[model samples]
Target: MSLKSSITGNTKVLCVIGHPIAHSMSPIMHNAVIQDLKLDFVYVAFDILPEHLEKAVEGFKALGIKGINVTIPHKIAIMKLLDEIDPLAEKIGAINTIKNENNHLIGKNTDALGAKVALLNAGFDIMEKNVLIIGAGGAARAIAFSLSKECKKIVILNRTEQKAFSLARDLKKIATIPIEGKKLNEQHLKQYLFHSDLLINTTSVGMAPNTNTILIPKEWLSSHLFVFDVIYNPLETKLIKDAKEIGCKTLGGLDMLVNQGALAFEWWTGEKPNKILMKNKIIEFLNLKQC
Candidate 1:
């Protein structure tokens, strides 16, 4: 049966909320799985302004929305608004998923789990590896917190140097790994990449409409590096293209996105959706080659 035809008064609601949410492929992958599994749930997206977040939560509670996937600006802000937070998400200071049970909201961060799974699935080992991360936003925080557990060293570079330093300091409190934050520049990019085994871009630098932009110079990349950019829109960012051209192993954000969404899916419905179906639905919708 079609998704619309399958929906009944009892069908549960699942959705993702964020500002500028039009770019999200969450609904595509999620709904595809919902339909594929014949589950009594419908997935959707909401373009929620930050100012209306509280009201949005109230509405979700009133309407008994079963699950919510938080994104972008809402990830950090929605924490205090929730009734309870998972411990790891609290440590990361961000949440990308929320479950509502009997009017109480519980928040969780699956981004870190998503990234770690994505890397390991791609055969990139993080054990004792030197890692270079770009950006100091929520995504950066989640990825850094996860990588800190196993990686030997981490250097975070952000356009605003203070944010990078602040993230580094925050991470140091919970992790024993050598973590450094510095201003993002060609000099530092070159210096860090020299010894780095993994390079992850947590920023939206090469997202759609600005696909040509690249932070690190092509010359800075080496064959020994494994580049992972968390932007999956274009499927391949300029940074990924450059790294690939230079003979470096690379992984795009599609897998990370799917893995995280899958984690949220299972947490919400107690059903493990076919991750391959979720991923391929997105790849087909984006009309792009598989990354």
Candidate 2:
């Protein structure tokens, strides 16, 4: 173990496991909270592939590790490897947080609850609203599960209609809200965007450096709409900026990242991680590394 490791501390261990984890901000955001609160914890990233997930969890238990926050391709795969799944995680068919209680590996989905917190913090009241979600990736699935309880209707639009339909079908088994999946072609998207109370872009279309591509045309967007995009590298996506131009309330992925990490920290350590510290630390740490 590294000298800086808190493995010997009273608090348990925590890690994030994924492939291509070099770009992950989990350590920066989560470790800041650990330092700020003077908690005995260290959060690291394990760049393991899907095939290695079961071995990773087994090793955690063998090594007296406390818990982990999973991401990407491993989220769904880790579900079956865990001893228990939270209701929302079970409903969403995904896992982002895993807690190791001695030999038991428990699973939970913080992304769903995190998205709900992100939406409310963005001044959105999703209750009884018509919401349109873009992308059919893991993030999109989490957000859809989160909004299902509040939205009057949930419409998923994606380049791959089949994936969107798959997501809707999976979520319907858990959520009472009506869910619709459709292709995001010009005509179909325009119809949904204009009528949607909220437009959420979960795709990575407007990430860092590629900030010019708004998911939908700004002309079709209304000032009454609320927009959220899960891209934080540039901090603001083109969609968020266009939404701002049209006077639509908006949010970015940073809040979701922090909230979900916080929830995972709480789940493992039985303590709440500081949100502002987590957010600011991620920004500062990211900036410093770029320098």
Q: Which candidate is the best by TM-score?
A: 1
Predicted candidate 2 versus true structure: per-residue lDDT over 1-291, tens digit per residue: 232445564665678888878888898887777777777887888899877778898898897778788887798888888889988788788888888887788888888888899889878888899999999988899889888876899999999989999998998887898889988899989888878898889988987667787668888888988888888776777888888998988898899988888888887777887899889987886677658
- Total clashing pairs for each candidate: 0, 0
TM-score of each: 0.97, 0.93
Off by over 4 Å in 1: 288-291
Candidate 1 displacement at residue 238 in angstroms:
0.9
**Model-by-model lDDT, in order?**
0.93, 0.84
lDDT of 1 by residue, 172-263 (tens): 99999899999999899988999899999999999988999988889889899999999998988999999999999999999999999999
Model 2 segments more than 4 A misplaced = 1-11, 289-291
